[model samples]
Target: MRRLAYIRALLLVGLLLAQSRPAAAQTNLIRNPGFEAPYSAWGGIGPIQVAHEWTPWWSEQPDHNPPWYRPEWKPAEAQFFPNRVLSGERAQQWFTFHASHYAGMYQQVFNVVPGVRYQFSVYAQVWSSVEDDPYPSVLPANPRLQIGIDPTGNWNAFSGDIVWSGEAPMNAVIDQWGYMVVEATAQNNVITVFMKTSPDFANKHNDTYWDNANLIVAGQAPPPTNTPAPPTPIPSDTPVPPPTAVPSDTPVPPPTAVPSDTPVPPPTNTPAPATATLPPTATLPPTNTPIPPTETPEPTATEPPPTETPAPTNTATATATVEVILETIEPTEGPTALPAATEVVAADSGGSGAVAEPGEATGNPPAAVEEADSTAASSTILVVLVGGLALVLTVVVLLLVWRRITGAG
Candidate 1:
């Protein structure tokens, strides 16, 4: 009973330590990127090409830049400004959108990766035209603007399968442009855009203009967020070291003794018995009569055929193997609530950016995200409670069994 008590105490202490552990293990790591909104500044409009540094012209209104925007007139390389994706309905807004019209493509590969998501868009001209095809055709074979998985291998000109394809509209083609925005899988960082065919635009090869190519998070891992805090170039001055404290010697308590409770004895199932030696010379006669065996023919060794030695048979043994599996249980909410090493990734996801707290991370999870975390925490608590209850029930059952066996119930 006393041994059992010590075991229980130890288990309690262990569980307490477990509960007190910090969160944020590698297992809880999560990465998600958002959409890159239209760079038009306005809500919509596209199928325009910008140049100079090789950019794209955004589809915004009031600035037609054309009655058939002059080819030599050159436009701006349009890009989504408030880049990256939105979380959900409560999310600010998804950046992913599609393009409307098309002549050529503007393509570039970025060095910096923004957030955990990659952004891509498709533009097509349905009702209107830039070069204005005489006989407009809404063919399903409407050229696609592609984004391939070329890792800078085959640079300058992109080379790979067409990633962005726009479904051809019905025969109502007057020749105009449409838009479609999307977030690509973060695994591929390469970006490119070019018309699949030269139907409307005459010189498809030379006409595709792209500019203002901001490839955020191109080389580095995904950015914490699209609106990442601007980098501070100037380094701060060296911090002054605080003065070390001096130790003052006071009269220490002289060898105080700790008192221990007396150890309890374990209960025994049976009483100890006295021992005696057996007499070597005394031969006791058997009182009980033994049944006689029926007579049967017994073969002599010489009469029997020469016996053959038996082959070695496989021996079976009562053996057991113990295996330990480290099921690194992760908290459902995420990593523990303690500071992690620099190697651990922290999602600095937010439009506001992460403001460093005095001794903690500045970012707060969105309301939706917080709700998910709370649900996870409740689940963990429920599991622990059920486990504890089961253990207590087992102990009670054991006690009842002992009482019944000893007739002490």
Candidate 2:
């Protein structure tokens, strides 16, 4: 009973392990993260909109606030946006590490779930132009770029700013850039990313760049640890089963060594019978020899029978008629030799005594077969011309031999 229980427990553990699912890879939730398009998809502050998907934010306060204020956050084209851009051209440009720039931009992100941890990241840089701000000697105030999430699109319901930095500030140096990443669990479904720069009244040419903003859902936690199984206690009063009661089927004894060795001698002797079996197959060679003789006689047998058939008799009669006509024409047309050969070819093609084809009488025969027959007739005429030239040469040699014998006499 204890063994049966242990077997059942082991099966249950294997079943659970088979049914468990593996964790999936993390996916990004933010759309149009590079801000390479027009600002039609993003909500922007009225006059200070610099780049697409990017809105500038300031620290100014107004009582009649439509939030119509601009802060130090502005757009600056990186090295890749094609234009005769001024020292501070505010347009989306390609970054060395990213596809395009956001340049101080933030937009509302979708599909954020509550209590799920997410990672947000962006590459940001700062640029200063000699034409815009000439005062390099005076150290400028560092710029601030902030990312935040808000449940509501309004500024009042702002969740705490995303903690993308620990002790290091989110400030970018002039012509230097780095990635800023933040990890936090969302409290709501909608995430509104924010980008803000610190107000610098003294520095007019300060430009900040942001690009490749992304939001990725972090990996989920594994299932809770399984509870430990209870320890099995040993029985004290149970009587032990007899060893004789164990199954006799399990312990199969190996065959006796004498029997195994005896079988080896039999196998050596058994090869004689195996070799004896080959003679019956060797006798099959006599059977195969009779087949080739029968097969070789087949071609000679079939060829003579075909020549005796009525089709060959018809063809032979046609060729004999063509030969007599050629001999009669050869006496009159000695020089016009090829033309007589052509006529012979036409006669052999059954020109005068030709039986009408099955389709020709009812106009049902295919035109294609008629064209093929015409091509075959032309090829046969060509072969006859070559034979006629050889006949002419043979006649010329016979006449020369006759003349030489007469002159020798």
Candidate 3:
């Protein structure tokens, strides 16, 4: 009877142990979570193959293509590495060789209870370098590693319904492992888990390794660990101080008045000396010099009154001779008879008597008449010159006046 009791007790304890175990250990919805299976070329995409239960995905946008698309260009490569495994004999690795890619893998998990919460986690590490330097002394190895769960069971990696976790810390030490976790409530009976990374640089050794992914039922949520502590309370017996009074409005001092004892000098009002208005400067008109009139010699009986000289038949020659006579005549205060008067008459008579007539005519009435005639001619020429000068002066004055009017306008 005691042996029977002992057996029953052992069975009861074993059932309790099974029931108390963590949900993660009891059920993991992920398949091939450790990546123990060999990666095969199943998908048509080249240069990288996926492990079992994972579908390879990448951004199809042209901008997301590899930086260099050479025939030998491989944006990413994935394979199973036995030496780098965290637990099992083999682990999965995805890397680039002087190239970068925005790609990852996903798996759809089904048979989940609707409205139940689920947690997805994965252990990942990165070894990003440049020029064979493990840490890339200059450039940062910003391989942003993260994991996500799409509660809607969507295959699209960029679906908005996906809940992503914070980036897994980059392992400064190679092969060092870190885990990223994200939780989501099941919207339906199916969910999708994703493992993704985007290395900022296309270095020579931008490598990442992932293993031990998990998705398990999350039971009752744990209490928040970061709840703020209640503020300290004042003691009941402590005395309270009244707040000091503050004026609602400050008073402004009035401006000081000038002292009556201080005298200010009065402004001098002496009128400016009246500007002397000198009469406008007198401007006298140009004076016209009076020319003495030629005296007419009275005709005496000894010489009958000289006959009026006939007009020369060749008027042009006569006029030219008269002009020559005027040019040769010297300036004098009064009209003086020119000796060349007979030559002038001779030239007007076609120059035939230019020399003979002056000698033939002695101190006779004809000579005196000729002298008188010469004087008359000089007077007429003087009058004409004075009139011409006046005309020129009038034209100059008009031009100056016109210029002044235009300038003022």
- Which one is best on TM-score? 3
| lDDT tens digits, residue span 1-409, model 3 | 9999999999999999999986543567788887766667433434455677777654322233223111111212223444345666556677655555455678999999899888876667676654465443334356777677888898776666777766555543244566566788889899999877666545555577776777887654322222222122111111122112221212111121111112211111111122222222222222222222223323332132221221222233434554555555534433234345555554555544436443465334376456667677777778557655655665565566555544543
Ranking by TM-score: 3, 2, 1
- lDDT of model number 2: 0.42
**TM-score of candidate 3 on Cα atoms, chains taken together:** 0.48
TM-score, every prediction: 0.22, 0.35, 0.48
Q: Could you tell me the TM-score of candidate 1?
A: 0.22
Better of 2 and 3 by lDDT: 3
> Model 2: per-residue lDDT, tens digit, 318-349?
45555665555444332243333344444455
C-alpha lDDT (0 to 100) for residue 366 of candidate 2: 42
Candidate 1: what lDDT? 0.28
Pairs that collide in candidate 2 are 54-105, 58-71, 359-365
Q: Would you list the rank order by lDDT, best first?
A: 3, 2, 1
Error of 2 at 107 (Å): 2.1
Cα deviation in Å at residue 136, candidate 1?
9.4
Clashes of each: 61, 3, 0
